[model samples]
Target chain A: MLSNLLVQLINGIALGSTYALIALGYTMVYGIILLINFAHGEIFMAGAFVGLMLVTVFKVHIIFAFLGAMLFCMIMGVIIEKIAYKPLRRSTRLAALISAIGVSIFLSNLANLVFGAKPTTFPPTEEILFKIQTYELIAGAQITNLQILTIVTSAVLMVCLQYFIKKSRIGKAMRATSQDYDTAALMGVNVNRIISYTFAIGSSLAAAGGVLVGIYFGVVKYNMGFMVGLKAFTAAVLGGIGSIPGAMFGGLLLGIGEMLAVALGLSSYRDAIAFGILILVLLIKPTGLFGTQIQKKV
Target chain B: MLVVENVDVNYGAIRALVDVSLEVHEGEIVALIGANGAGKSTTLRSISGLVKPNKGRILFEGSELQKCPPHKVVEMGISQVPEGRRVFPLMTVLENLEMGAFTRKDRANIKDDIDKVFAKFPRLEERKKQPAGTLSGGEQQMLAIGRALMSKPKIMLMDEPSMGLAPMLVQEIFNIVKEINQSGTTILLVEQNARMALAVANRGYVLETGQVVISGAAADLAKNEAVQKAYLGV
Candidate 1:
């Protein structure tokens, strides 16, 4: 029983890492602009497809493919922000939010036209990323190389992001922008550039999460980002929509809770469980766990 | 050196400033004194590139400023200590100071400049690691001024620095304003408290309901019977 619990915890962590990566995108964008950025999941889906193309059509190294996907999503995120969100910045919040929803539908449909609606499989984990090896923990519990890779990569990326925000000049400017937009510009920050950088960084992180999901599941679909995006968004909301560490913690907790449901033979209700928890959290705490003093949309 | 010629600003349907014009030459403290709705802030906002004027132009050191964004305005050696001391509340005091120097490229001199700011307001250094939001109102005001100074601005635009301060703190801010002006940075001040403003300013512009109703040397404006009756509470 103890071993079973250990296995579930490890599996939960690996799954949670991907959710955390995507949640970071949602949280960061919301932090700065107070936009939900619904199209973010489509960016994740696009990242998966880009990774698939880089690895298979171009026959590149998995590492290069991963990096390429992230870069592509970064550019795409910035372009989407420019074309969709920027013009509506002066409009009411509802207008921008509707735009975000519109962008999400447009991107997902475009992906559907290009990549087909059916799910496509990755070539093979062994042929690309690494040899899949399972290590026995104690008894009846196991850990896999893929799990380790997912958790470690996400951890590293998050740490680098934290360090950059804490240390770099642009990062400080980003924080200032998040706190007060007009004031930041008054302080000589090119706010538009900061907004672009924000979209780029958030989208890149979501892209990385998408690639990891593709590798772990060995499948990618045009609409895969739809459900996963909602789940990651739920994680963001659960952790306080605009807080960084809150997203991480919320994702892990959700993943663990889902795995716990599966362990208890309630696998079919996994999605429902995630939403139920969200409802419960919100009922108790209107602001997610790490909601700042007050982040009212201006 | 700056000049504004026949500028008009409107917010949607309501006009904020109409045919407003003013000027500030090198090495002088200029004050704009007005009542609550007299468009004092709109004038400063126009100069800082926060609002666009419908008619006329603003020139800073011979260059047009109407089309420049706020950041570009800062780059042009003009920084504003905005009303209410809108410091980045969540950021540490040191970070707020660093952000003030965001447009500067001389990374090496930033530290020395920060130390200079500390010399002027030593309390900030002791609380450098603490967030600006945690500071008292007066400390936050000092941080805002220090942060603006970090840009090495040739002209500092201050709006109502004494709006919500105690009597003693208000005097202290005014004295600091004089000291900053004496140290060679030109100033364009907006104040509802006309008494203190005229006392501190070299030249003054009296804005009444969005137009320059009176303009002259500070001493002359202070001595005007109408000015004393309306603004100075004589």
Candidate 2:
């Protein structure tokens, strides 16, 4: 039973890596503009679809398809920011929120229109890193290379992001604009350009998450982003909006919590388990685990 | 040099400034002093492109700035340390200073300017790694001014630098303002603290209800009976 728990923990890390990737995108977008891009999930779904099309129809290599998917998603993120959010900036927050929802619905239906309502499969390839080996002491428990790759990739990406934000000029500009847009603009930082770049980076992360999940699950669908996106968003809130490392921690925690709940015979209540963690965390720390509580001036 | 010719500003139906005209020459400190809500800040905002004027032209070094954006205003050698010391709260003092040189291409000179700001405000140097938000109000004000100075702007637009500082800090800040001016950068100051403002100023303009009610040399405006009774509390 102890070995089983260890195997489950390893599996949870892989699942958590995908969640962390998606969550970073969500957190970055939310951090800078405070606008939740509802279509972000659909954008991830579109990325997978883009990758699927490249591999099947165009006979592109998996590696090239992944790059194309990221580029496509980044461009889409920029357009959404420019068209949907930028013009309505002067409007009420509610208007932007509603428009975001509109973008989500529009993208989901557009995917249905373009790709059709069917699950698309990637070309058969030996993409699995290694076979899962079960241990006797951990009876009925197993681990695989896929899991290790996911965790390692997630960790590397997160560390790279942290370094970029801390040590780079554009990254510093992003943090400043996120803190206060007006002040940043007055300081000669181009606020709009920074926001667009933020969306591009966030979307690219979501694309990476999409391609990995597609490789793991073996089947890509039009609606994959709905549940995963929701979960990733929950991760962003759990860690704290605007914190780079917080999203990774939140994602991994949420993934493990879900996996453990299922492993312990509560499989039916997995959604409840995920939400329960969110509510409990909010109760303990209203601002989130890593979020700094801002004192609003009257 | 800066010139504002018959500028007008409005928010919805409320007129914030009416035919406001002002000028600041090279190597001079011009003070725009008034009570609360006199639109002194608005005038500065207009000149800095933070707020657009409804009528009239703003010319900076012979270029019209009707459609210029805020950062472009800074690139034109005009930097405004806005009211309330809007420092990047989460950023370190050094990072905030670096933001001041965002538009510049001289990476080496930018580093030197940062050192210059630290040299000017040694308190900031001690707290260089600390977040700007954690600093005292006076320190944050000094950081704000220092950040503006990082841009190497020819004309500095400052609004209410002494608004919330204690009397001692206020005096110290005024002295720093005089020092900054003496070092060759022109200043366009907007302040509600009229006495200290007029004292450091080369010339003064008293704004009332968005209109320039009185304009004179600093010493002349300080002794104006109306100015003394209302602003100086004489």
Candidate 3:
């Protein structure tokens, strides 16, 4: 029983890591522009399809496929930002949000038209990469190599992101832009370029998450991004909307909580469980777990 | 050297500045003194490219700045320490100072400039790692000035540097302003504290509503009866 629970925990963490990756994009774009890119989920879906295409059509290795998907989605994200979000920036918040939803709908429908509405099986990871390998922990709990890879990759990516934001010149400019846009421009940071870079980075991270999800679940669908994107957004809000660490923490917590609900014989209520936790967290701490209360000056 | 010639600025339907002109020559501390809502800050904003003038031109070393964006203005060597010490509240003091030099390619010299800022405001050095928002008001103001200095600008536009400070801190800030001017950067300072501003300024402009009602040498302006009656509050 203990080992079974441990296995579930490992699965939960792997799932959570992917959510965290997607959530980072949401949090970052929201942080810098104060616009919720609702179409982000579609970007994730687009990434999975791109990865599938690279693998099936291009006959590339798994690593190359993953990278190809990321690069393609990065450009796609930038294009979407420039086309859909950029022109509406000075307009009302509702206008940008509606634009995001419109793009989301448009992208999903485009993917559906291209890939068909049915779920397509991904090229099996075990066949493409290495043989299926599971390590047995104490008490016979098993952890798969894929799970390990997912968690480690997520950690590394997040760490790199943190380092870039804290130490690099462009990253510092991002933080400044996030804190105050006008002040950043006044300091000679090109605000528009920073916004584009932000969208590119966020979208690429979401794409990476998409590719990983395809490998883990062994399938891809046109609309898979909708539910997962919402969950990841919930994770972002759960941790604190604009805080990077908060998104990571929120994603892990949501993933574990959902898995644990299933472990508790509530598998039927899995979807309900995720939203329930979001509602509860919002009710208790509206600013979120890691969100700071910003004091406005006169 | 900087020049604003016959500039007019409007906000929606409201005219903020009307036919205003001023000049700051190289190596001089020129003060623009006026009451609240007298377009002092508006003029600075116009100069910094935060707001565009409806008419006329702004020249920095014979180059037009009317349509230049804010970042390009900074790249052209004009830096403004905006009102309320608008530092990046979440960033560390060191980061805030680093942002000031954002336009420069002298990566190696940035550290030296940072050290120079530290020497100017030792309190900032002591709290270098702390967030700018966590600093006391005076320290935040000091950090604002220090951050602007990081650009190594040719002319610094300071908007209400003495605003909201205690009298002693205000005096301290004005002293630092003088020292900064002595070190070779020209200054265009806007202030409500007319006495202190006039004391430090080589020349002064008295703005009423949106127009420059009085302009002369600082000493002469300070001695003017009408200037004393209105802005100087004698």
Candidate 4:
């Protein structure tokens, strides 16, 4: 039981990384503009499709495929921001939310039409995991290469994002805009430019999450992003919607909690387990762990 | 010096500011006093580049500011403390101050300016690490003013600083506004509190229904029968 728990812990961390990356996209977009960017999941799916096509159809290297996928996803994010978000900005939040839902549905259906409804697999990798140990803390348990790669990739990405948001000039602009868009603009920050940059960064994160999931799970499909995206968003709200670090913390907790629930013999209720946590968190800490409660001036 | 001539602002089809004109000379506190929806806020918004006027030119120090973006206005040394004390609630008081200086490139001057802000608002210094939202209403107002001071603006535009404060806090805020002006920063203040606005201001204008209804020296406007009835409640 102890070894199984430890193994699940490792698995949870690996899964959490992808959630963290995708949640960063969700949180960053929400932070900058207070928009949910519901189509963000479809952006992740599109990125995976881009990677799959690049690797399988063009026979590109995995590295190039990742870059290509990120670039395409970034462009798609910018296009969505310009067309879907910008116009509805001054409108009610409900109007924008509905539009976001419309965009999400449109992209999902669009991807289905373009990529077809078939599940696709990445071409065989020379190495999927590096097995480090066969010695079990309990009988018949081991850590594999795939898990390590997943953990390392996600950790690297999170650290890079931390550096990017904390140290870079554009990162400062994002933080400023997120604090107050009108005030940020008053500081000579271009609101539109910063917003587009935000979308670009977010989409790239989603793209990375897409690729990592593909390698870890050994399957890629147009609909795969839907469930993960929802989970990532759950993690985002769990940590706090407008906070960067909150997303990371929230993702890991949600992933671990989900795994533990499954391990404890509630396997049939995994999805319910995730949503139940969300409801509990919202009821208890509506502003999230790190999120501040904001009050509008009368 | 700044000049606003025949400016008109529209919110959808509703005109918020119609044919509004005003002038601000160097080293003076000019107050705009009016009731709600009298376009006092809109005129300041137009000057600060938050709202682009449909007509007329806003000239700041000889440059036409009719089409300049909001941030560029800050770069040009005009900063506005917006209506209702819209401080970044989640940001630490220090971070809020840093945001004020976001356009400033002179790191040395910025440090000194932060010291200057802390000096002016001692309460903010004690709560510098606290988030702006946690501050009392008076403290938040002080922080808002302190944040704008970090921008090192030649002219500051303030909207309704005393709107929701205790009477004593309002007096304290007005005193700080006077001190800010005396320190050589020109001010364009918008207030519904006419008595206080006129007390600290050298000149004053009264706006009504998106136009300037009255303009005069602060003392005269304060004593004007119409101003007395509408804003001063005299």
In DockQ terms, which candidate is top?
3
Query: Residue by residue across A179-249, what tens digits does model 4's lDDT show?
Result: 77887786667889999999998999899889878877778887887899899999999999989999999
Cα lDDT, all candidates: 0.93, 0.86, 0.93, 0.86
Give the residue spans of candidate 2 off by over 4 A.
A125-141, A295-298
Two-way lDDT contest, 3 vs 4, winner: 3
Shift of residue B215 alpha carbon in model 4, Å: 0.7
Pairs of residues clashing in candidate 1 = none
Model 1 residue B191 CA deviation (Å) reads 1.0
Order of quality (TM-score): 1, 3, 2, 4
Chain B TM-score against the true chain B, candidate 1: 0.99
lDDT of 3 by residue, B27-70 (tens): 99999998889999999999999899999999999999999999
Which 10 residues in a row give candidate 3 chain B its minimum summed lDDT? B80-89
Candidate 1 residues A1-298, lDDT tens each?
Answer: 6777778888988998899999999999998999999999999999999999999999999999999999999999999999999999989989999999999999999989998989999989999977999998777789999998999999999999989888999999999999998889999999999999999999999999999999999999989989999999999999999889999988898888888877777889989998999999999997988876653221
TM-score (C-alpha, index-matched) for candidate 4? 0.90
The fnat of each candidate, in order, is 0.79, 0.66, 0.75, 0.62
Cα lDDT, model 4, residue A145: 68
Interface C-alpha RMSD per candidate, 1 decimal: 2.7, 1.9, 1.1, 1.8
Question: A177-279, model 2: which lDDT tens digit per residue?
Answer: 8887777888888888999999998888888788878877878887888899999999999998777788999999999988888778788998899989999
**Winner on DockQ (3 vs 4):** 3
Model 3 DockQ reads 0.77
| lDDT of model 3, residue B20 | 99
Which predicted model would earn the best TM-score? 1
CAPRI tier for the interface of model 1:
medium
Error of 2 at A266 (Å): 1.2
